[model samples]
Target: MIILRTPRLTAHLAVAALFGSSLLLASCADADTTSNTSSVSSSASDSPTSPVSDSSAEGTGAGNGGTDSGASMLPSGSSSSADEAGQGVGGNASETEEAPKTSDEAVSEAVNRVNRDYPNKFGGWVFKGDTNFDSAADLTYAKVEQAQQGNAQYETLLIFFHKGEYLGIDSTYPQQVVSTAPSSRGLEVVYKDWEALRDSGDANAAAGKYTSTVTYYWDGAQVQHEGRIPNTGL
Candidate 1:
């Protein structure tokens, strides 16, 4: 090592060297700090973090909410299939059958049929039992007689009808009494001549000794007539 020539000069040189060394250390420290800051900025820029979109979050929320709310809106005690099938409130079909015809209605129909068909034939003639017509075994009968003028009797006739259809007609002897009865088979029309009994003057004649019986039955296509029975003389 070389020694200094003068003491003051050595002291000044030593001070200058010390100051230069401090400046160099300060510059090195600042450079190191700047380099560390730049490395951290580069790393943060390279590894990017993705942000969530508003549309994706809203779509997920709607998908979960729609499933639960759709089931609660249905009516009670009914399913969606029931509505689609068009079922009624009472769950039954409507009744469309018509009511049956009454007896009075049937009688009215018979009267109307006669009036419509034979209007001019029985204008002045009167019906025997217009107010008290009784239809039985699907057969209806009406007796028409000429109007009595001063106790004079005219032609008397019996008209037969089946279910409002006109059948054949029969007439009793003039001035003879006639009666009718209904049975399961058909209608029975009986004829009695009171004049014969009156003329006989027999006491036993009051017991219907001269009564004749005739039965009329229906055969689906038309009315049928059985042969007349002879009168039984009591």
Candidate 2:
């Protein structure tokens, strides 16, 4: 009876030890499954799901910053460029407006026109002799004849005529006596047919005569004068 009881006790002790070992193994497996689940959740949370949306937001922020910086810098640069262009245009306009008109140009234009239009009427001589007398035996002929017959008469007469008339004239004296004496007799005459001279600020006809009473003088080299004539008729 004692030997049988000892065998049964040993067998019961072995069965308990096996049961405890199985429980411990089940607990370890449960802990390992929980750990694996926690690791998977952490990895999933770290992953970027909406890559396109996140990149778009960052790009929008950068674009807005760039636009603000560019807008702030525009006014100063644009205004300076505009001002420089305006100054250049104004300088060019001033230079063009201030250009000069010369006296030689005006004189040359007048002389050329007169010579071209009145080719035949104007004689080669610079002065015309008018004696205010009827015949060779007339009263006041000797003085003018003597002066004309002198050696230096041609040169003196040319200066005097040019000073009075501003035009060339014939060498011969007039046939008829229009006046008794030389009082306001000399005149600067331009023909009505001379359109060029007429257009170039010359005096017009009045009472059937286009005559200018303004005096002219040659100071050895060039002709000089001081007078203003109305181009239109009186």
Q: Report how far residue 19 has shifted in candidate 1, in Å.
A: 99
Candidate 1, residues 56-140, lDDT tens digits: the string is: 1100110111222211111111111111222244464333333444655644554564455444332544565642234333456
The residue pairs found clashing in candidate 2 are none
Error of 1 at 56 (Å): 86
Query: Model 2 has how many clashing residue pairs?
Result: 0
Error of 2 at 209 (Å): 91
lDDT of candidate 2 over 2-71, digit per residue (tens): 4458888889999999998998999899999999999999988876442211111100010111212211
Q: Per-candidate TM vs. native?
A: 0.37, 0.19
